[model samples]
Target: MKFAQPWGRQRLSFLLEKAASREAQTWRGYVAKKQTSQDADVSPAQRDEAVRWLTELHGRLQLYPETLVLAVSILDRFLAPIKVRPKYLRCIAVACFFLAAKTCEEDECVPSLKELAASSNCGCSPSEILRMERLILDKLDWDLHTATALDFLHIFHAMATASRSGFLDSIGLNRSQHLGLLTRRLYACLADHALMQLRGSVLALALISLELETCCPDWLALTIDLLRKAQMDSSALIRSRELVSRSLSTPRASLPPNTVYIYHPLQLAAPARRPLGTMETPRDQPALPQAAAGEESKAPPPSPKHLAHLQKVPLRCKASTKRKVEQMDVDDFYDGIKRLYNEDATSAVHEGATPGGGAYSGGSSPCPPLQPVGAS
Candidate 1:
């Protein structure tokens, strides 16, 4: 159902009652504490529940781990502040995933709206499905472009694999192992379901770090786990995990998302766990900030002219086999291309005598291949 903006006195009182029922600190005290409490839907068991559902759904849909992680993020985000009844938890979580999929996947060809409603235990019609989509957008403050907690885990994995520590190098670990560790850590964070209490940029990183530390005490072990994921390269970030963690002590920006995120993982601290010669070395190393900045500043977004050129490029053409991939009905240009290319040598012979629009092998004069008799 479409809910009115929660600003009216009735809505405000509803929120107030929600806070009290959940024993959550009043919104008035949030500024002072800066630490979020376990949100109404956030708990050890709840996180596990969300993870299990997403993991299964993602597997069935054949989406990326990051995509599933995005679903988890949406669940955390919408459920973070609201105190929805437990009966509605599945509804809210499923709605968030549906919205997140539309946001991330260029192609939203998964299950139908009814299927999603069934999954969430809601018997909403397509119209209700559409309404919930709007409600979610309003609740999230439209911060859809920002990175999720899963991205941070990826950053950690990259740094861990890039570690030059004798311990890691001797074992000849790869990025796959690093990514594996990262995935485990992500799930394990839910083991305690402490993520809801985590907030902002660096603090969230610290909380995840603590959880990873607990799962496998050894730094090398965590590094090894990240090596196993294989989704991204771990080399670029190997030596910078510690520095990233230290800068995470206080977040400046959100470690940057996507490619820009790679350059400045974080600044280094004084010589400590990683010795200069042993594995952690920074003396002659290139300046990370400059490298990262250079990459980000390389070019501005495409201009209108460029966009026009891109638009001019047809999505598909008959001869253009690559970009011209067809869907549903395949007619028009495809038939023409096939007719023209029927026979390499029959061009002069057949000319415009072709019957059907598409090429025909059973024709009186079949076409020839793209070769002729002569030099090899």
Candidate 2:
């Protein structure tokens, strides 16, 4: 029998949407949690050490993306219920990764107990590894399939790049590549406990949304709507976006040399841009006045295009005494990007088929891979 195409546009779109929604629900429902008070009992230094070791172990194994994510989720779930002693942290982490490799990776890809112990130098006996795996399974009720932000991120990328000709839509070519890079960065950020407060869907959607604004402005509205349909919490989404933007916009000079190395070579090659989509004014245009000696300067009036963009977004008002004017300027800048999307939407749809889409950098590392556990 002749087989049908694996990915007709409609079929692929449906599959992507379904996968996104299912994974989003699974992550938010089963795995999402605030940093537990129990974590406080363990010194931040100890937690950081364990996380760093886990990162090295994961990299050395060359594990699949799903395996690394699953292992980390297991570690989080296990720690949430009961605090393990600091000394055994590496052993527990190893067992978690070992179990994850078995479940999510091919048999050939999974490492043997002896190999794992030697590589990590944790001195965990095979029997100890088995016992810890059993303990973790019992604590987690054997629910080893927790979805991660990377799960949703993959679905979103497929959807954004969906094409009938087995090629990525050119309109989103740059975006798809940039989104992949940002997604990897988010995974790197996962090593940080503060970012862990966000659920998978929120983090994935926020990073995707921001990249869409930067590289595929035309797709911004549709992506946002799909994300909202996927049940991303509104407040969480905003906070996640701000966090991503902040991290991306931070000056390289301000970041530690090691922190900068976590990014893919593409990210490392480019200088960081300002947050909130601030564009450089034409040099010929008059510069805006500085803020008055003590009081804040009034923001320049936004053009009509900027007003229209704000009209598209759901607005919120929170009263604050400090930096109120600066906040308004930031709001105006985002609104302008939304308007840019509206203007470019038609052109993007008409010229969808373009060869040679954006290229993604290989390999992944967490953002600022090493830092003081609670520095930020």
- Over the stretch 1-376, how does candidate 2's per-residue lDDT look in tens digits? 0112335556655755676665655443333334456543454445545665677787777777677777777787677656566667878989988988899887887899889988988877888988988998898788787667776676555555552213335444444455546555765666656566677767777777775665554655656665655655667777888876775565631343366445555545643443232333345766445554124423333445535554443333233444455566675665565455443332343232223322112233233223235855
Task: Name the lDDT value of residue 273 in candidate 2.
Answer: 42
Whole-model alpha-carbon lDDT for candidate 2: 0.62
Q: What is the C-alpha RMSD of each candidate to the true structure, in Å?
A: 29.4, 32.0
Over 4 Å off in model 1, which ranges?
1-48, 108-111, 118-126, 165-173, 199-376
Q: Which residue runs of candidate 2 sit more than 4 Å off their true CA positions?
A: 1-40, 43-45, 163-180, 247-376
**Per-prediction backbone clash count:** 22, 2
Shift of residue 112 alpha carbon in model 2, Å: 0.4
lDDT of each: 0.47, 0.62
Pairing residues by index, what is the TM-score of model 1?
A: 0.40
The residue-level lDDT of candidate 1 at 132 comes to 66
